[model samples]
Target: MSCTETGAALHVEGLCWGPRPGLTLVDDIGFSIEAGSRLAILGPNGAGRTSLLRCLYRAVQPNAGRIAIDGVDLWSVSAREAAKTIAVVLQEMPGDFPFSVRDVVMMGRIPRREGLSGWSELDRERVAHALSHLDLAHLAGRQFATLSGGEKQRVLIARALAQEPRIIILDEPTNHLDIRHQLEILDLLRTLKLTIVSTLHDINLAAEFATDVAIITEGRLTAFGSPDAVLSPRELSAAFGVTATVHGAAASGGTRFSFSLPRQGSLS
Candidate 1:
């Protein structure tokens, strides 16, 4: 994704939302992301990481705030126009009927296509490129429903890649997967060179793969900065109420995060 370093590749200002009493789920939260930077949103469940993403994606409306891409307000354009730049991959890829892996990914092209010309040569080129980039070429002809958890996750990510979106939002992209596939997916994300914002359950993975990490606590953004700066022992313990240790990744020659046994309190 091409962008200017004017503060961030994506920007959010005064973003807040909730229902019923409509409590401020994300209170006055704001940040900027540079182009080609990766940010990992880390917190315990219900910390509002996903809610913040929904607001950015224009899925659920914020009670008040301005969300901008490059510098334009997202609400100023129609949903289709917004979609032309944003793509998302959630824990589950939602669809009712059967869809070929290739077909589902090609659907990403619809946003960029002009009227009824069908899939153009350029579109096919993009699909093939995304498949290869994602290492999903072998599964291109497979049915989406028949794939395992890890394969399905990668396919969803490939579909997002096919969109050529400027900003990619992934919520728990590694919900169910073996250790090897988990590392593979994380490594792939590290090399994408796009403006990526994702919510990850594994604090270690967040630290390892992200250039910057944000710690959201009780509906507010509590910490934001480089992994070494933010994911310290005190901060990790306070945020998740767990014991954790940060060290070198050993194999990758980078930060490696590990959890220590909790002394007390409910396991978060």
Candidate 2:
């Protein structure tokens, strides 16, 4: 499957979500993801990142605000149509599935599937190509459960790529993977000219991988700009309760941030 060479615009305005009549988990949030650009949403745990992501991916409906994809309101888009355009590689990986690598990755082809048929030669080729990109071609027949955490992460990413999506939404894409795999995934994302919106735990990684950083604290956006402009020492201390120092990475041409010792009980 392929998308029109059109740019995918992910626009969100005044988006809000939560349960019951009160206690808003996310409130009056607004953001935009332009064509072929990447935005890394950064926040501490339970800072409404997951709630915001759920709204973005239509996992949950927002009580207020507009989320549009290429001028189409996200709520109006059919689930099947949304599946073809936006694919998510969520933070939580699926378990207890006794499927082979090929079988799992082939699920990406579900959008194009008609009723209850099987994979065609083209489908197999697409799966193979996806595996090859992640260097998992040889493990096509291997059990997904037997693979390492890093390998499973890559397989999940491959599945997302197999969808040929115009926009990719990831929730902490580097969570359980080792340093090497983390860098590899970020490197791949840097080269892909598709619109990407993701939640990230590592502020340093976001500094390197993201074209723009959106910092959220207590369910509100605090800062949004280029890494150097947004991830300041002051913001770092307040946002994550850390004293961070940013430095240049000569090899990747990206900035690296290091944290200093915290005061006994407070940030000074």
Candidate 3:
């Protein structure tokens, strides 16, 4: 429950990844995330959002460019050191994991330097707080496989929270949830004072939750700025090839958007 009060800053420069030059999935991407800021990456399918994320978390090495975490080059750090600093919640989970929800959450503590002391009282307290924070206390004893998709997603997020990471990277954290749970999860993220970088399918959710937004398409970053500045009708039409109407978020004061397909034979 107790994380570093200040999150680490992230910087990326000319980040590219693929088996070879011509086949790059993420090309010439560059961005910076100030400490404790939330950034949402939006793009159409196969635009390489996930590929870019994989580079940040070091799932795959970038063929070119640099990734720096709080002024430290991420690739220069040991994998264990990086794990302690960054926690990620991906879209998929191991369906047949033979572990209880609490057990799975406890795994997050493995990255910390406990020095052979084994699971400590502090660890248990953190796990408990994460469970309650995610509204999973009653399901603590339930098997992970028995939970619904929404519940499973929440469990993954709880696990990430228990890690007490400086930065949390999520890939479509709202993928499986109903509207209520989606809002609930995003709300919980909003309360955390950590750096959050996520790939979101819903432009509305990004506008509501993110302080900054990056719009990428065809493996390139097209727009990056405040959600209000980046999520415009022009960017929407260019990135998605659809006609959209942009509006204010009403009482929430965030940006809102709606879209419609192009007219017949209008597709370029």
Per-model CA lDDT versus the true structure: 0.81, 0.83, 0.89
By lDDT, who's the top model here? 3
Q: Write the per-residue lDDT of candidate 1 for residues 1-268, one digit (tens) a residue.
A: 2322112378888888886465777777888877778889999888989988889888988888888887888898888777767888887666453999899889888878899888999889989988999889999999988887777878888888787787788998877778888898888877686788899998777777888888999888898888878988888888987787777654475766677669666455
Pairs in steric clash, model 2: none
Q: How does residue 237 of candidate 1 score in lDDT?
A: 82
- Which runs in model 2 stand beyond 4 Å of their true positions? 5-7, 248-254, 261-268
Q: Model 1: which ten-residue window has the lowest total lDDT?
A: 1-10
How large an RMSD does model 2 have? 2.5
Candidate 2 per-residue lDDT over residues 1-268, each given as its tens digit: 2464344888889988887677888888887767887899998898999889888888988999999988888888788888888889998887777999988899998986778888878778878888998889999899999988888888888887777788888999899888998998888777666788899988878877887789888888888878778888789878988777767753567667888777788775
Candidate 3 wrongly placed segments (more than 4 Å): 1-3, 113-117, 248-254, 264-268
Clashing residue pairs found in predicted model 3: none
Q: What is the per-residue lDDT of model 3 for residues 1-268, given as tens digits with 9 covering 90 to 100? A: 2248567899999998996767989999999989999999999999999999999888999999999988899999888888988999998878998999999999999987478887999899999999998899999999999998878888998999899898999999998779998998899888888899999999888988999899989899999989778888888888999988877664478457899998977656
Give residue 265's error in model 2 in angstroms.
9.1
TM-score (C-alpha) between model 1 and the true structure: 0.89
